[model samples]
Target chain A: GAGVSQSPSNKVTEKGKDVELRCDPISGHTALYWYRQRLGQGLEFLIYFQGNSAPDKSGLPSDRFSAERTGESVSTLTIQRTQQEDSAVYLCASSSSMNTGELFFGEGSRLTVL
Target chain B: AQSVTQLDSQVPVFEEAPVELRCNYSSSVSVYLFWYVQYPNQGLQLLLKYLSGSTLVKGINGFEAEFNKSQTSFHLRKPSVHISDTAEYFCAVMLTGGGNKLTFGTGTQLKVEL
Candidate 1:
């Protein structure tokens, strides 16, 4: 793809339900990241993937938040037992390499947990 | 550890006037600084970044920012503003030799009026 792309631009799910958000980064990019932005809050780091290495999962807020990436391509973020506080925009970004390079962002997936 | 702070939550300015958005960061190691802009219902777009060399950096849409190492600040500034410049601006920092994760500040809403 020309830029980072996210699927299901908007989602609404009830509390206790599970939601999955997908992201497809640009081709040949070796670094991908997931972030969340709650209403009136700053962007919070979720997870990061670099090449074929184990992801940097230090930013996941809780045990309910988990993510996976296939090699250096598509990534998915899964939230289990969602709560109203989970409402936010999920953002995906990719960079040419993992050396603090310029990032290309996707439009983001807006999730509304009811 | 690295964290960014955008001091002003909202800044209003008249058209054609100059504007500045303040940002500061705290980090134990070297870091990279960046500014991103977000229009309504859209994702973030990279405005500029400071990696190495000169402190002054120019970005898209005639925007510029200066990185002050001593104060740990990277403030975005524009000599003159326009109505189209109204958007949410964010300051982000990435550890120079760390993973792909980035720490972002709470955004500053820039409102340009006639």
Candidate 2:
């Protein structure tokens, strides 16, 4: 794809249900990132991946939240036992490298845990 | 740790009027600065960035920002704002030597009206 792509642009689920959001980063990009944006708050860092390995998973809010990238191409963010407070937009971004200082963003997947 | 602050939650400006969105950051090390704009129902796009060269950086849509090292501020400005420019603006900071994790501000909602 010419840009980062995210799936399930909008997802509404009941509390305690699990949800999975997918992201496909730009081709040949070596770095990928995930962030969460609450209704009226700033974006909070979630995790970062270099190639197929995750060097930084320090921002995952809880154990219920886990993410993985395969083949250095596609990534998935899964939220298990979702709570109402988990409602937010999940954003995926990709960069040519970690030091590029610029990132290409996806449209984001909006999750509404009711 | 790096942190960003956007003082104004919202800024209302008349069409063709000048506008400025303030940003401040705190970091222990040298850092890069960036401004991103999020239009309604759209993804975030990079407005501008400050790496190492000049302090003044120009971005798309006639927007510009100045990186002040002493004050640790990266204020975004526009000589004339159009109705189309109404969007949410975010300030972010990334450590120069650190990984690509971006610390973002809460964002400023610029409402350009007639």
Candidate 3:
């Protein structure tokens, strides 16, 4: 079976630029999540979408970070006016349903802000 | 808000030796516990999860974890580790309700030496 997939395995951009990271969740998955992992740090929740509705967006560090999922399928995490602090790996995950307790993750998109 | 703690920032063990990574979580409600492994240049992989039924759960790559309710701990253990096990480990907890958002702890780097 195909697992989650992400685009642009690596991206190098200058500060103040905007970047978009894409994620393709597994087929029939109704739940999608976005997370960020700073260098030598842990995974931090960014946003979550369930069937096109974002029920939790509190984990998004700032307004500069935004994510959207359409029809419980592909998802995109966009960082506006990116800063050096936003240099990290953006991760995407999906589960079959709510409370499944297991999320399949995709190879993260590594963003380097200079 | 729920929080997870990885007591060890790094753990170094000789190949073929036993290893344990400690994890503790604090949450107001019952939650799902998970352990994920991230190899260099790869996505996070689900090691094991403790949702319900049994306190002990086994996962891929000879990994296992035990969920403790009273102590609020879910520690991962492997009797023998290979150099291939060298990677970063993260402990996470997701609330039973409230949209299945994950709260992750600072990662622990496991170095398996030959």
Best candidate, TM-score:
2
Quantify all predictions' global Cα lDDT against the true fold.
0.92, 0.93, 0.90
DockQ of each: 0.76, 0.83, 0.79
Judged by DockQ cut-offs, the docking class of candidate 3 is: medium
Would you give the TM-score of chain B in model 2? 0.99
Quick one: best lDDT, which candidate? 2
Question: Which regions of candidate 3 deviate over 4 angstroms?
Answer: none
Worst 10 residues of 1 chain A by lDDT: A96-105
**Candidate 3 lDDT, A53-106, residue by residue in tens:** 645888889999888777878888999999999999989999877446678899
lDDT tens digits, residue span B1-114, model 2:
889999999999999999999999999999999999999988898999999899999999999999999999999999999999999999999998967888899999999999
- Give one digit per residue, the lDDT tens place, for model 1 in B1-114: 889999899999999999999999999999999999999877798899999999999999999999999999999999999999999999999888856577999999999999
> Which of the two candidates, 1 or 3, achieves a greater lDDT against the reference?
1
Give the per-residue lDDT of model 2 (tens digit) for A1-114: 599999999999999999999999999998889999998899999999987664599999999999999877999999999999999999999888644668889999999999
Model 1 misplacement above 4 A: none
Q: lDDT of model 3 at residue B74?
A: 97
Docking class of 1: medium
